[model samples]
Target: MKPLYNFILSAIGATLLSGCASSPDHATAGHDAAAIMPASGGPLLPLPGESLVPAHDPDDGLFMDALSSWLEQNNAPPNTQYEFTRIDLDNDGRREGLVLMQSPHQAWCMEYGCSLFLFRAHDDGFSYLSEISPVRGPLVVAESQTSGWRDLIIHVSGRQNNDARNVALKFNGRGYPSQPASAPGLAMNMLDVTGVKIFP
Candidate 1:
């Protein structure tokens, strides 16, 4: 709860200072285009959506390790800010973790978007499970399942995509697609925004 409060304040400050402008041709909600939605009557595990950090960090600095590795690879500093969320991606009792590594220097993002990682919990702690590169939010944990895992509705844009889109990333046994722009499209009738947005 403390982490969530801090994250909200940070997000508000960032948005006010940066304006968080959108691309000129990016699709707006006015389009009413086809996009991801929860499967009919799928059970939802209620959780906070607008938090910038997890209520509790994964044990043993599992998340920080992954962030440090990514920052080192990109030559970004370890102090970069990020957004985090937890969801029951497998419809299991335990929730998995989602981290969006953000930096003022654009270290983690490409033209497409920033890198988003999903961590699976283990008895020892949390372990690296899968990654979705170049992603933006607010992301959705959909009720729809693939390979026994919930699908992710991610905001995608940039070079590969002429206009921005909400792409559905399904777990393919191994993991979700690293590149969301190349994923399959959903029809336009997913009007109801079923799941909560994961980050601010």
Candidate 2:
């Protein structure tokens, strides 16, 4: 309730007590992107056992199960083809999964764009994180972080692929914005980012 001197003192105390703080749940103890990046940092890299082979693997029980659920929930065709990209967003050993349905029947896509699904890796399999829809690619992974997660920059094509605008989706301790049009507008040159192709 104190928004002045007490806040300043609290901030100072926070800095001092940061070392003793615990990491975000289901995430990290303390993960710095620099700590995981290669000496000569290049693009985002997937940590060990985090790569998605064949992009869409039918044998991947976890992924298949999640996709099925998503499709059923949306009343989409169960056989909708999808492409996936795996990258370590939180600098954790496990890479987060980004998926886009792009094939035969694009029931999930609209005039604005297609939907993207986010998932986190677990020892058992991929767990659903969130669903960001009506966004187009190429998506960019930003150097900036929020709530210990990397920010996302994606193209949001206004009606009929016209009036296009790129938006920034910062993780709000739980997930990114489900509707990107309401998210903050982002200029291409405003931040350091790695452009990623998720639809190809």
Candidate 3:
């Protein structure tokens, strides 16, 4: 009987210690240095149908869900980080989605550098239009519509090799590889060009 009692007491003590260890610390629980406890925030309420919501707001659960679905569909390799930039590429008073994927140190060598993907949201869902390669640092996209078709102009640069770099100016439409132009020179390395016109 004595042995059983000791074992029971030890098990109880272990359970108590584990519970306390899993709980968040007071500092992390939003308590200040003065030890004043914080109040419980209000509950979250869903927006009504047809409510006006900003597209880029992270708090919007619908937008977050859609973005997550897109990311998962792309199947980004492990250790790759993506930065999304929103711009009005079409200049139609609506913002377009531009995603820049970079590999910090991944097994895929081609993904180690930079890649750009352009997307536009529609009534059904977002549509992926084109993808460009050798896109290094920051990216800026602008729209140039001529005749009855829309053209997306993308500017990207990256270190091609030791002591040598490359910058490419490409365009895509409903059809891809329609417009291709490139310039390479040692002095032009890393220099930002205002805009390069792509001829189809």
Candidate 4:
């Protein structure tokens, strides 16, 4: 319980800092957008309307209505329980919506993991961008090999004898990679320390 509480606090802190202009500027200046490959290499889907981020107002009926409508439109289960925060994932001066939801599959029991969803903000509402199941760590937006946008980083560790691994989901101009690689972007630089403890 303490660990979970700590994680929540850490996530909230990171998210709040995301909105501030004083946050670390990791952008690689003078980098050309053309250098980075487009995301997924698939057709970029356009939003149907002005999909903006829903306000964090629980008591407002209209807010609930819009939230429900967005959830239904995105095929989320009606009974799903989730909490969300807004963060500028790409450092593009726009905040992306991040939602942590309880997974339906209880069999995949995890002490500090949950389902994560990333939503792109628009004028009308937020649109579902990507999802990562069993996210064991806070979602961090960082600079990647791509010049145009920041990448999404998640750390996951569940099985025994394995240290937590950081997975970077780089954004292609359109969206993030549908299937991320085991070691995304400069993971080769990371030394393999599986089953080896440095701080014994």
Name the top lDDT candidate.
2
Each model's C-alpha lDDT?
A: 0.51, 0.52, 0.34, 0.41
Q: 66-91, model 1: which lDDT tens digit per residue?
A: 33343334444434555554566775
RMSD of each: 13.7, 15.9, 18.8, 16.2
- Tell me the TM-score of model 4: 0.50
Task: Summarize candidate 3's per-residue lDDT along 1-200 as a digit string, tens digits.
Answer: 00111000001111111112123212211112222111211122212232332443222122223434444444534344454444444434334444455444342125324455555544323455555543444422323343322433433333345423333343433423411224333233223433222211
> In candidate 1, how many Å is residue 157 off?
2.7
Q: Which stretches of candidate 4 lie over 4 Å from their true place?
A: 1-67, 103-112, 143-147, 159-163, 178-181, 184-200
Ranking the candidates on lDDT from highest down gives: 2, 1, 4, 3
Give the per-residue lDDT digits (tens) of candidate 4, residues 105-124.
35222564755656665433
Candidate 4: residue pairs that collide: 39-172, 50-124, 51-124, 51-125, 52-124, 52-125, 52-126
TM-scores for all predictions: 0.61, 0.60, 0.45, 0.50
lDDT of 2 by residue, 1-200 (tens): 00111000000111111111111111111123221111111122334354443333212234334434444445554345555555667765555657665544346677767777787655445556778887676777776788888888877665544756777899987677888887766766523556443342
For model 1, where is the 10-residue window of minimal lDDT? 1-10
Please say which candidate is ahead in lDDT: 2 or 3: 2
- The alpha-carbon lDDT assigned to residue 38 of candidate 1 equals 11
- Tell me the lDDT of model 1 at 167: 76
